[model samples]
Target chain A: MLRSGPSVILFLAWRGLRQYGLSSIVAAFSIALAGGLFLSTWKIKTETEKAFRVYDGGFDAVLGVRGSKVDLVLNSIFHVSNGPDKPLTQEQYENLKNNRAVKEAIPLSGGDNYKGFRMVGTIRKLFEDHEWRPGRKYELAAGELFADDRQEAVFGAFVARKLKIRVGDVIQPYHGLDFTGEDSVHPNDFVVTGVLEPTGTPADHVVWIPIEGALNMPGHAEGLGFAPSSVLIKFQPKAKREYLQLLYYYRNHPELMMPDILMTIAPLFEKFKAFEFALTAIAALVALTAAGVILATLRSAMNEKRREIAILRSLGARRATVTASILAHAGLITLLGIIGAFAIFAGIGSFAADYIREEVGVIIELFEYDPIFLQVSAGMLAIGLLSGLLPAIQAYRSDVAQNLTPTS
Target chain B: MAFLEIANLRKSFPSPEGGELPVVEVKEFTMQAGDQLALRGTSGSGKTTFLHLIAGILKPDAGAIHIDGECISEFHEARRDLMRANSIGYVFQSFNLLQGYTCLENLLLPMAFAGEANQERAEELLEQVGLDHRMGHYPRQLSIGQQQRVAVARALVNEPKLVLADEPTGNLDPSSAAQALELLRKLCVDTKAALLLVSHDQALVDSFDQNLDWRDLNAAFEQATGTS
Candidate 1:
């Protein structure tokens, strides 16, 4: 018998599906809806996890007053805390800096804001020594870093865009970090010396200043040179033993125990693991349900196409040909769904990127074409194949003679 | 050897009374290449079953059927499918054109199964059937006569050695039916393909080279039903 190749089969399948336009469209979009949800959730989880891993401001550990370690990581690394955590004294900061395992220790003093943007008091080391991500140092978009003792401030990219702050603009700092408009405004205005390019980190919304500027705020005067909000520490890679010893010594030391304990970022990431697993599980369930939808739609379509299958069989198509045609029909629809899902994700990313970055501290790069997406495409294709399996078998087993005869 | 041959062919189906009912019992039949025969039978006389068995669409319970030097009855299902695809053209009573396909696509459908399609030849056949202008029209868009003409065109597209016209004009009106029958016979003769036309119309049977009364040939039909 004459044997038709895959191209012919595909062409015929395409023609057949196109004839049933509404059902084909409905089936395709149902898969797309599931695929889109999976893609969005997967993308958000990946980006957020990446952001969390690097959000620590290049510090290995945080030294703060005894409190929730998760809160300390949240406040010190991400700068997102409801209320102030107790501070580390100047002596504690000096001890941390003097530790042999601590390669660099920088003081972070907060409790001030400029229109809801956090006013973080840090030293020159923050701009010069920190890497937002590995090997990526802070690059100024405009102006220079702040001096050691001055009212000058450096704006993060988002803060500048939101408040229209630029180099040479002066903004009054509020005495407290709240944005209720009731917080007393500081007497001195802080001049903007620089604006940093977007680092895709929480620093993008912070106003950086010399530690002394935070100290000199009206209520903070008495606490000047005595206490700091937290001390961020970077450990020497070769001094692991010394680092562990120092951490153990500090946590157990009677004099330094109350308000100067160290909290590493490892525990915070552990907590995030559970939350991300739940999100991924939900997304997988959505994909599975989508597969079910594909199966049901194809199986139902098989009943309608029984006569068509018989015609093909009568024309010399083997059972395999009919089966392959059904599979091809399903594969094409699923592939279209995947393409549609990507387009939808791109639209969502374009529309919600800035908002996601601002709120979730994770940047959404639309259609980055991650290698993992190849795996996702395969998963979708597998679903397509599986969903079409029963129907293909049904087509294979169709009673050709019965279907070919005209109904009375 | 005859171009088309059948001997001791037998087929049966299970009856509602829980017994085997013999449907076809043909002792011998032969037709030369390019010969045309009109077969007439009652509704339940197994006329369609004979066509189906000859086409290798159904395996006869006991028989030897040969077409174009191939013993199709002995062939495996797949080989039979291939033989049918390569050697036989069937024109069904209802036209049986797939709904979504254009007339040209319908004509080319068999070629797709054969893994070879000749678009120029298909167009020529369409032109021969007076349907060149309607090649792009869907089956549903055509008149019943026009659809039958397309079916006729489809039947000859593969240039098979045997063409089965199963009541090819059954669905058409009188004028259209006459036109369809004439077109089917003319095209079968033009292509040098043997034709077996099944119909209930005696006047149509007179147009063919031979007239076959199916009930008289099927001994099993009378024995099973006792309807001499």
Candidate 2:
């Protein structure tokens, strides 16, 4: 008995591709594109999910005068979307701040823009509550956050990327409720006093200035009695449920002048979670479609390889061996395509992260492993394997004897 | 006892045009070790089908097939594959040498398929086929004759007891054909393998130890059926 080597038909399997001509190349490409579609969609959805999870850690109610739900949600926290220019007054900010049951309240003011990006005005101490630290907080890759409400500003990561901003460069902000367009004029010249380390969030796209400086800006005029888009509050440990009830009572009191159009942000966050799940499902479908596309290509190629398949059987190759050969070949191509797609996704992640933060104030770090990624990838792979099975079996079940005959 | 025996073999297919079309039928055929027999026929006269059935690539509708005197007709696929691998060596007219592999790789193919990779034996077969210098050349790089020689080497590499070749030299030039046939015959005699050569070339068939005309075999099949 002559001892054989690895029973692998990898060599013959490879020949099967070459024997068929240009068909295999088409299959490889189709499989690759399908895998890439699954990969990129998964990456984007995963990034969005990750960014939302980060947002989840902070904030509760969005207390504002009036606006659309999506717009209010965006500006209340994001500040880039549309909202009232005249947010809550100092008295209103202080009113929430003084409420003993409130525990802690962070006030946000809207005023200026650095180029086409916003300069958010907020209380300084709240940065600490946001867990913004010396090592982690607005560390100036170049300078420091403005210490006073003067002509000074902290540049967002994206703005810095675009403007090539550096310490001591004066930046003039446009006067508008929305910074969608640039209208830089009127001594809005703010020295680039700081550059924040990338937070991979919308904050990375902002220009932070003192609330006093924002109020002094000409754009800050003609707007009054408007509560800030939102006030984030943290309850004391073991705080009672009555505290929220009393706060709501005060919010509606006629004398309080609180707007009836208050949107509690907790529900908004729950809505976001639901939205994330829907999107994840959508991502899974897209990935499966990619796999389905690959299977269809393989099925098409089966007809073209009939002669070669017949030849394999004539050589005493069992039906299963031929089937195994097809499966092994296509399976390998899919796996390789998956790896290639992953590399492609990794390469584009940073740019994508920047895009999210700038277009919407959501920071998305590249290396963060969102579980949705694995879920989507697994689903896609399962589809791919399932797709390969039928073709492989067909290859196995084919009549090898008839195939070998030249006349057939 | 003969190396291969076929008794009342019948096989057919469900033709697209209609009911079962009888492809090949043979009654009481036997070949001993060291005998070279040639089967001559037209394209559709069941020549390839005969080789296929003997090689266990196809199952007969009804027949008895024996390799080394043991009935293999009723054996399952796994058992038939083992018998085919151990006893039967086959060469196709196309040389079917996997284009991607080198000559040595082609020669080693059967051994690899049968899980009987004997590197030394494979090298020796390459040397015997006069392809020692071209072992590293791919089948595509070799001429048709050289490729056939490599195929022959592959067929005989596993040292099977019976060698079956379907038009072993059909695609080769005259001189190469002579060389390939002489090699097949010599290898059969030397290794004690029952060599069954199928071809349309009457001249080549006449030179074999015995000749089985497909016309006579078909007549025999019909007579046996008519008698039964």
Candidate 3:
């Protein structure tokens, strides 16, 4: 015999909830769907930001044709840029490489694909002299880097597995940017010479080759010397001490004005803030719908609950006890919903990990114990209790004398 | 001071005709501790209304209800609620047992409000009601007679001073009703709690130690036509 009115209320409320098992499950499931959506969206945002930060390669700036700075960084670094601007001339690349403030400049050019994988044309220094990530240089899993200007290709880990091309195998390049093109440039059989180790970055899906071969390709834009799609510059450590001076000089210099040197990483993140805000609004709407479902379920079930509540009153329950019981019922439903939502999140994270990695190069880390999850759960509990307010008030005002008599 | 006392008690509800519809009017009534009384009346003749007024479930329009020397009608709603929980036990016509709880759980329900009830004593009361064998059975699994017996056990769980039963055996067959009535009366006596039962059955009324007709106790009815 659990004494105290509140204990009795809890016991009775639990019994009542169990009596309508199907309705209880439906209420909990609605909340679970909302919670799961909210959690996954947050997870995606966290992982995407982490990926962007990690892949910045410690570079200070990007220089490209006067256009979207985001597109310049995307094209030069990740091979996902959709810019229509013409490639920069070799004279511009040399001019940037010779700048006193510049420590290194890596040239990039690409408009072709090999069997659904983007073909990147760059110098051997991109592999040997540059760090693909801070303190981490590019290493081959098998064979060597492309040393000859002949049409030899180096496959990323995913591309090699996708195309099943070994070191001695030959493949043809498609002329267009999109990978699904049917027009293969004949007599341009590129041989696979190397396969790089997985770096968990966008490079896992590209095919690397010497820039000279890409420049000599028949359909490529004719230039005075080697042309590049963009330039990735690593500034001298001294530039940080004179950041304002360098910023003004880069933004105003005439020779560097045809193409712009953009402090792009910071601005790109500003755009992501808008995307994050939209996702948060979507999560809020889902939670609102879930709250509505819980409220409607309780209100609809109040009819059956009237008799039960009256019986409790007749047994000497105070109005507060009755109200507490109703709130307790709602709290229990939402608590179960939160538990189910976590399970659903884990299940979906596991199921979508490979696909997300393949499409966007972000690993969906499952079961990463985070305090934000606890905060989300607490917020949902509050929502559940708030949803119960109307029904609890109704229970408190129940007519014990009338509802006691058996209804005809 | 009486174990239960009422003076000039009156209660009414609003009629559809936009006037007060008098439900109960009793000039005086009293019951001593451990006494058994039967209130017999037709349906809608204010029998249950009087019971509600005495139990503090409804407020009297103009009167005082004193139980154990304290006038309960003067208490606030929450105080009345607490008094009812601690001192009064009700057994309804339909047995009103919560559906999912077992016989033992139903017996322990009042204790949850009134505070610590001896579990051993609850089991003993269930045995006294001839339900020792059905302690684990749910309400729906028991016969009407068995359920009423469980209700009787539950009413005595808090060891209240007064037990109000309204047509407790109304839905039982005659034999089951007799058995249920016997168990209810026995438990009330054993627990030393006064029992007040309302019923329309003359035969049932005849079994009690004292019986009063509703028309005899209703002052408003007597005055309306001057015929009591």
Q: What tens-digit string does per-residue lDDT give for candidate 3 at A1-408?
A: 587766777786787678767777888887787788778767766765556655665466777676666777776666675743777787878877887777878877788888666888888887787786678888899988886478888988888887787887888888766766565664577788899988777787889988887777776666546888777788787766554555576577654432222345445666678777887788788788878877887787778889878887888878888889888888888988898878777776666677767765545564578887998899999998899899999998889988888421
Better of 1 and 3 by DockQ: 1
* Full ranking by TM-score: 1, 3, 2
DockQ of 2: 0.37
Q: What are the per-model numbers of colliding residue pairs?
A: 5, 17, 0
lDDT of each: 0.79, 0.67, 0.79
Candidate 1 residue-wise lDDT, A263-355, digit = tens: 344445566677767866776776777677767777888888899888888888888888898888888878887887777767665666777
The number of the candidate with the highest DockQ is 1
How does each model score on TM-score?
Answer: 0.91, 0.79, 0.81
Model 3 chain B worst lDDT window (10 residues): B219-228
Candidate order by decreasing lDDT? 1, 3, 2
lDDT of 2 by residue, B58-163 (tens): 7888989888878887889877776776778888888777666677766565666677567788888889989899988988888888888888888887778888
Please give, for residues A169-246, the per-residue lDDT of candidate 2 as tens digits.
877777765555543465656677878777656677777776666666665565553345456565554556756665
Second chain TM-score, each model: 0.95, 0.93, 0.93
Query: DockQ for all models, in order?
Result: 0.53, 0.37, 0.47
